[model samples]
Target: MGFGHIPFDVSHALAGGMLLMSFVLLYQRRVPGLIAALATQGGLLGLAALWQGWAQGAAGLYLTGLIALVAKAVLIPWALSTLVRRLGMHGSVQTALGIGPSMIAGVGLAALALVVALPVAAGGSALAQEDLAVALSVVLLGMLVMIARRNAIGQVVGLMSMENGLILAAVGVQGLPLLIELSTAALLLVLALVAGVFLTGIRERFDSLDVAFLEDHRGERR
Candidate 1:
């Protein structure tokens, strides 16, 4: 009657939801909207982790879900929102690549993820293999988001979204340790702090959050 007793289909569905959010992150343009999407993605990641914990009979993964929900869904987004408000960065997101090209690249990355993960996970259950593929696709898409964006906030969103994908992948593996889960959460927390400091410094120096501005400033440094 516990987590392992539940059907694998449910877990697969939850993981799919997480992947959907990753795609959502790719297309968002507004800083606030992007943060909202990230928060939603984090929430979905928590749900996925919860289901994975139950399905794999790993009690510690429940803690992982809790950390994701509290830290990523709630705290990080809240912090980012405050930063956005303070910086007055509610402007349109800047992309290094156009939207059409970015979407095309995302699709290609997803397809490649499936091709790679499926073969690697072939020895496992169908659900596990598919989950791994989905998780990998999400990770790839998150990286694409980072690459496509020229805005510092957008890049931060991409980095955090990619971390969520990594958590998804870790929870999919049965017998993953409690220490590893805690360690991952701690790492994400540090990343958020570092990103905040970095973003604030950028805003202070250039009075803009565009990464291109940083590049221009680098030339001035010499």
Candidate 2:
């Protein structure tokens, strides 16, 4: 079963929200603000999932929705807050490129994704295949943010954004399998735990978290 009332509208709105969050992520330079944005994006994802659950009457979806809300939305930010504190990071941001250029490129990317999506999607409901396009755009943009940024934290945020986009795409596919989500979540948590330990150890060894310094270390080794 699909969404009951406004399945088309609801799906498009969810896809649009994902795209909007992608744009927001492109320009965010502050760590805290970026984390906040991640949480906000996660909340929107939960809303989208909840809408799907209501429309489809799937009880399991509630678990997925809750995970999006509580784990991605709340727990991640809380963990980041604690991690940043331990690192004594007053303020850190990677500024290797101007924000203006990045925004322009991001817009171009969205346009490209939309254009490319049209031909492949034969035709169907309002968001039948367009949701896939939007999902792909968000994933690509998140990757760009991760690659272009000079901050470790920003890259982490970008990674999380990409993960959320993946989830959004799956949810739009009607009855996507569930076992993978639970398994992936467990692994992701472990990744975060390892990341936290690495962050602390890196700071202790190098006495800094700046990407430039880390690059220099790598250069010296080579």
Candidate 3:
């Protein structure tokens, strides 16, 4: 409730940028495009952390912001780019819904998120409330993308987008300790590594990165 020390405009800008990027990500079909959008979101997250640190004078927040920048913004993107190039899997997966339908669904999902969160009124300030709403919307949208798209790469991107939303939610919560954040970062790394391994397995068996081929493997036998 205090928020006297925090820089409202800068933090809001950062959170807003990430929220906008989530919408942009939904429209991107190319692997490179998704990676770029994710990197942009990461940058915005770092900016938000920096603004929070400045406002609260919390050294941990500054470090968390830097971690988000270096790891999510830079390292993750670089690794994904390399993985795409190395695997030679640049094609986008065909979703069950057409692009138009996907866009409409995304709009609906965002609206649903806002509507659901409005009653709770969890945030102390307007910016936190906005960020929380937008972040949850992004998370749901990411899940939608994953479910609609049939491609493994698209699913991965969707998962990353969900992670971005999680980070946004974490930042919005007040008084969360830095240790939890650090542990979260560690867990994210482990998850990404596991995903990479799963990707390799998918590629090895199918000779392609498309999830459809692997998905129907069981059903096709009969």
Candidate 4:
């Protein structure tokens, strides 16, 4: 099977779902809710990978899908939730930007992604072009999530979400080595673990997970 055999609507829908989850991540004010949205986005990424695999008849992508589903959707969320509970960060998330502004920024970023990716991918199949556009949108929105939130956990979630976008883009592209996908998935898992440990240390030293406090600590050192 070729890219032409793939249903553009289904692939686009899955990618769009991940993009929508990025928006959801942007507006989420609670740690648990944000984690849930991240998991959902990861799940969508896994499904998109699986869909691409089946459509393209690539067996390696099946493993990629399984890794994404297990690592991103399951393990990462559970780890973040555990960290949140242990750190007693169940309250509303602190944000550097208001919900309205964050959402507006997300919309603008999505438009910018389309503007950049569509032309760049113009020579590709329609599905690939759409995937690239949505994937880029998701990445930008993830960055927005990180910038908008003051919590370290939220930043970690944003990072993970961005990785999801990268994975979607990789899966959309044909003949990408399975090893690269696996390595990317492993790197994301390691990053989440490191961020979790780093968050724990921040909480221990500063007695809070809000990254704004790091600036105050830096000022004190100065």
- What is candidate 3's TM-score against the reference? 0.90
The residue pairs in collision within model 1 are 3-54
Deviation (Å) of 15 in candidate 2: 2.9
The digit string of per-residue lDDT tens for model 4 on 154-184 reads: 8999988988888899989997798787778
> In candidate 4, how many Å is residue 153 off?
0.6
**Model 2, 40: alpha-carbon shift in Å?**
0.3
CA lDDT of every candidate: 0.85, 0.77, 0.80, 0.88
lDDT of 4: 0.88
**TM-score against native, each model:** 0.93, 0.88, 0.90, 0.95
What range of 10 consecutive residues in model 3 has the weakest lDDT sum? Answer: 1-10
Please write out the lDDT profile of model 1 over residues 74-139, one tens digit for every residue.
999999999899888766897889878888888899999999999998888787788889989988
lDDT of 3: 0.80
Supply every candidate's count of residue pairs whose N, Cα or C atoms clash at under 3 angstroms: 1, 0, 0, 0
**Model 2 / residue 36 / CA error / Å:** 0.4
Model 4 stretches astray by more than 4 angstroms: 1-6, 220-222
By descending TM-score, how would the candidates be arranged? 4, 1, 3, 2
lDDT measured at residue 185 in model 4 versus the true structure, 0 to 100: 72
lDDT of 3 by residue, 42-144 (tens): 8888888877877777778888899999988999888888888888876675666777888888899989888887666664566667667888887998898
Which segments of model 1 are wrong by more than 4 Å?
A: 1-6, 220-222
Return whichever of 1 and 4 wins on lDDT: 4
